[model samples]
Target: MKIFNTPSNSSTISGFLLLGFPCSRKGQILLFVLFSAVYLLTLMGNGSIICAVRWDQRLHTPMYILLANFSFLEIWYVTSTVPNMLANFLSDNKFISFSGCFLQFYFFFSLGCTECFFLAVMAFDRYLAICRPLRYPTIMTRCLCTNLVINCWVTGFLWFLIPIIITSQMTFCGSKIIDHFLCDPGPLLALTCKKSPVTELAFSTLTLVPIMILFLFIMGSYALVLRAVLRVPSAAGRRKAFSTCGSHLAVVSLFYGSVLVMYASPASEHKAAMQKIVTLFYSVVTPLLNPVIYSLRNKDMKKAMQKILGM
Candidate 1:
């Protein structure tokens, strides 16, 4: 119902104000230090995953290879927003240049979309490994894995190109202030002077469908895996099957659980501080928690890590 009323060039690229946290100076400094530490640890965690996958030939299989790529994606994904968020915490201006804002918007969503595709592919990998064990080796070959990885990156980056460009071109009026820390669609859309239903619908549809389809695909993959494990009959077989699939399941649950929480909230009731907190929580899982979960269950991975680290 908000009518946009600005008389500026829509294409001129007026900058954005990121009103992150409205805290005192002391609180801001504390937050900066905390975020920096978390960012460093995230780098270390994700970096370790890539190095481990590359160093250990034993881990050169489709699953670990995908994981390494996912970790690499996380490195860029977290970097897309966290550094800028950290900077905003310190600066009084808190102004992001028009180009920088759009760039951040593009990379943040693109990388996130890539992560979704990667997760779906990983689910498919588990399905092959568990449900179709005999055929998995031949089917999930190195070349196929490489191709899948490439597809995820290309499709994800291209996914929002049209919608994002359109949304960016919309005439944002009034204060030009974004309440949240990142350049999320909801916040960006809210800043528009007039309500553009067509743009909103397009953005929502483009964003929602892929995520929903991939989520459904992941669920089906795990269901098939669970069914296959249940059919094993032998207690030992079932335990082995559960052990093989447990980590992936945990990662999927953690990732999607956070996502659902963040998105399910009504846009009308969106709280800036809360949204920022949820975003931080959601982003933290990728670089900091995912690889840890993936490798935690594998004794073989531990041995490989020790050998790789000369420990």
Candidate 2:
């Protein structure tokens, strides 16, 4: 019997070489500096939000609590890729160990999945606060909010565990060179000795299905929210409602828009450079921009951040 359990000819492959960005020595140094600055800024921005949420008594609410948690998630989310990417930029070999690559693949995707669930939960929170304000306090109690947060983390981490394990066990042969910065499923699968169409389909389904469902849920919530806002007698009240939701919608747009494009079709269909840009956008740039979007659009958060900064 042909055994799928054992690798055919890839046993010697100990690691995968991540090609990172195609740039000159000078360009690499410049990119290293640029991404380093961005990484530091992203950490500080998200950290400040968490601090602002924790220290500000006036900001102690479900929304802010969710925001704080999301910020915390973003911190680790970016960490899962940026530091390694920075290291790759400086290193000549640009080699990541076999296990290390898959571990990164797992954590990066798991964290991203968590972020998706968090976004959907945040949207739900907004729906409750805006559509059912009277019962919001009673329904979305501290206990429930905490449970929801826990559920997001648990569900997200668990969601991709089986798929990652299955993918890791497959036989990877020939070239261990991944053309992208990170250990993505597409590049890894492309290196496998045997083509597993079922595995590819599972990965695609896992990546796209949850995102679509969450996006649709967010849209449905906003539709009802829009309906309610228009019925408000006062323009000021409507403006307040829109202002509150605008930040989330902006974040949602930035995240979902890029991810949808990245995963809409097979990654092989996309140019390597384009893949890198899209992945970098959603993974690195989005996290950096999230805190700014929230802090600028949210007056309460702005004030809280200002207080923390002694402004």
Candidate 3:
């Protein structure tokens, strides 16, 4: 409730103090080691998926093409925050400059938004392949897929343009101390001197509406796919359909499960430590798991990975 007399522009505020994970020096070092290992694995795992898709001519279809781009997005998405967090672990002061913080904030949200668009597009690809098998080649052409990919990236970055600008212009209160490792929106908003419900709603709408709409669209796409698959008389055909959709469903669960929990409700009710843990679940754990989920359940993916690894 106490308002610090800081300027309304965030740039005027001195560097923010991020009170990252409360732990002893030994514990910090341990976490640093653990996070570092996870970060490296995430990069390598997703990187391998992209490489496999690119090098193997068999994996150049729209499905694998989308997966390759999605994997690349995951790499940068995780990098947008984790590296800075790793540095925070070793730094004594834990200070992040205003520009640096906002830049991370911008890229993190943009990439996440892009991922949502990509997932929905991926689902549509599956639907087209399953529901309209004969015309799929004509409908989902290479040019169309290329356009969809570029649209996802462009629209995501542009989606929050006004809302983020509005958020950044808000004044900060007495505390510039963020308890979490990243420049998460909840924590950033909480730091504002006065809460603007209208701006908050606009921001929340910008964040949640796309997620909800895309989620429903994906569900609908799957529903249609499932219905059509059931109509197929051959057991082998049914199994193949299920196998392809299953991997996507699993990846979706891992992502949206954590996201809806953390962001779909009031931010103030969740404790800072809980926020950190939940964010870490999606941000670090899921990226590492996605490549495994996509590859292990898929035949082409497995072959591609084997070829890439020369195994």
Candidate 4:
């Protein structure tokens, strides 16, 4: 590995200047209240899931273990964006320093990638439980579960590091004003003055590989699960099996579908709004809905909740 010199001068970042909705005071206030409420609900919902999982012994299986991890990650995911967004909404200058922007991207991308990998892992766990129930205990052993969780975070962290380093190296001599409420890779790349063909290639490769690999793994897992579901003798057994897998499949579809739309779509001038809306799905709305989706559909989760709440 080649060593790079660290710049001695403390890089000055003017902080991020968020260009939130409508450039007016009233607009900012209204937006702030709305996002704040969303933020509160995201925290409360994900937090409750984590607490319930930890408190209830019945929820100690691999599936709920990963759900608890998802709840925790969703809390941080919202924290990474919502607070800064609210601040940007109220402030006169939404200017973020170059360093601050990269830092934000690093954490945001890390958590986002982690969620993707965790979701895939959760799907595989479900597949094992439903399709291979006889070996579920041995298949998802304690050591294997620990390794799987660690690998997800480690892989996600590594994947985001490339973008952060490449983006950091590029000079930002041009306009610092980013259009979106938060710093995104698409907009940040657009802002750089330095030539980044190599960086762009690297970013694309990094983004594509895990997505392709995970997509195939998820598909294969679901295929086997479906095959197993169909072979069950009783209708009630099939329904129970399908019910367990449906929520995981739904959450996965929502996540990957929105992401593919956002990044893979054309980069025309009009697509900025489309990109923002897609980003909102994964970053804000998805996190809020994940716990709700998992809780409402799963009978075990409902019973666990009832026990946790002393109902």
Candidate 5:
């Protein structure tokens, strides 16, 4: 068992390296450009969505408030990894300090867990709005939203604290090369000399349970929502309800589908490559897409964007 310690005291880990995709100089340059483009779009799209929600009073519904939070979270999430990753792609020497690696892991996991909880809260909000429209406002008041946001942060931090501590415990005496761009548990665990099944199990359980439970709640809520929508007397009313639910459902599918395929499945022959893509999707693509999906399909957000853009 590894004894956890603070970064300074944890036996000075000399160098942090990466075991990212093996490519030639030309390929590396191509990847750098491609990722740069994606990172820019992620920032612009999520940033615009957050600004649109915050600056417009007309868009100050529970739905858009959650949307704003989601967009903001996505912005930070992508920024956490993509910038460093881009820098690494441009150079052969991918060395991060021990403290830098820990910090990267800390922030990335914190934001990732927060996003998971936020998605659940968003799903619950939608359930109230759709399945119990009359009670929506009373059920999801301003205070409730504030509480929910606080809970998300607390939950993420508390859950991640263990892994961070356990990671702090491990001594990286052997190889310092991380298989991915960021300091995720998968690659880090592989490098450690000490056994870490307990830590790995704990981290897996922490990430898996909330995600699974939240997904189940989302599924059940949508089922009820669909039932309610089907009973609406007018076709247009039903159409409207479907539109709202459809967008969230699509996002849920994309987020969880990629997660299960890339992470949940048994360790694969292409674990390294798959892990990279999966991490990219979960960290970048999903967050980027969340704001885009929520805002484009939402009428109020569209109007808010128009106002913000001076149209």
Candidate 6:
């Protein structure tokens, strides 16, 4: 198959050809089916959590409220890319218009940023609830919880705006064919008319710095929660405390573990297959697992899910 479109002399291209998982027809169909199943499961799982949190009066606490919002975010987060990806899997001409590609880039990264902030905020909520039990109710009031949720959405959407605009404005030329599935910074930058080292550095810094900072904040909060949990005299109390945190911690590990590997180094250094695999893991797999982790680890959530399922 022809890779480049006759070496366009123009500085910018109208759209990009996404070389999404170049494989036989059978492979594409199989992948389409597999990813379609995963996407549906992700939506159902996260949606169920949101429903459970909404209907279950027992889950009206600050932690569960935050969880509901997180689940809602996960719905959008996975939706941002999966449908397009699924479409690409089946299309002979896997093309994405410039505006559509950058919009995906913006929402994908912005939702990811929101997830980071939400995770940190959730960790802080757990810390307050476990380490400062007396102050938890008063400190994590409904109004405060609402404000934090708003702040996460607002800040996350705004965080990557400038970088995305900068990247989108850069001159893109040549083949106009992205080697991987999505319009990622690495593949996008590689398509630029001129190699701008400075722009690449700025994008990487913008992506990784916030992630590292939020990760550290989460770790610090959890450290305090761990200390406090350890001091509880009763084994049952300690068990309760750990159980409360285990779900969030599992989610944190899954998300950050994959994300750090994907973004910690220069994107150019990553092999295309590795990049696709890692991105698929965090973007697709992690969201599907989050609701399962939360439900299985929390008795209240499990009961609420059972109630929702009428089991």
**Distance from true location, Cα of 83 in model 2, Å:** 0.5
Instruction: At residue 93, give the lDDT of candidate 5.
Output: 90
**Candidates 3 and 6, the one with greater lDDT:** 6
List residue ranges in candidate 6 displaced over 4 A.
1-12
User: What ranking emerges by TM-score with the best candidate at the front?
Assistant: 2, 6, 3, 1, 4, 5
lDDT of 3 by residue, 1-311 (tens): 22235655543456578788979999999989999999999999999999999999998899999999999999999999899889888889898877777788889888888988999999999999999999999999999999999999999999867667877777775677888898888889988867789888888888898889988998999999999999999999999999999999998888888988988898888999899999998888999999999999999999989888889
Query: Which ten contiguous residues of candidate 4 have the minimum total lDDT?
Result: 1-10
lDDT (Cα, tens digit) per residue for candidate 1, span 1-311: 23333576542336888988879999999989998998998888778778888988888899889988998999998999889989988899998876778888999989988989999999999899989999999999999999999999999999979878898777776677888888888888887767988778878778878888999999999989999998998999998888877887887787777777777555667677777777877776456787677667877666766676678
Residue pairs whose backbone atoms clash in candidate 6: none
Per-model C-alpha lDDT, please?
0.83, 0.92, 0.89, 0.80, 0.78, 0.92
TM-score of 5: 0.90
**Model 5, 79-161: lDDT tens per residue?**
88888988888888998877778878988988877877887888888889888889988999988988898898788778778
Candidate 4 lDDT, 162-268, residue by residue in tens: 77887777655445567786788777677655557778778767776777788778989999999999999999999999999898898888888887777664334
Q: In angstroms, give how far residue 10 of model 5 lies from its true place.
A: 16
The C-alpha RMSD of each candidate to the native structure, in angstroms, is 3.3, 2.6, 3.0, 4.0, 3.6, 2.9
Candidates in order, TM-scores: namely 0.93, 0.96, 0.95, 0.91, 0.90, 0.96
Off by over 4 Å in 3: 1-12
Per-prediction tally of clashes: 2, 0, 0, 11, 1, 0
In model 3, state the lDDT of residue 161: 78
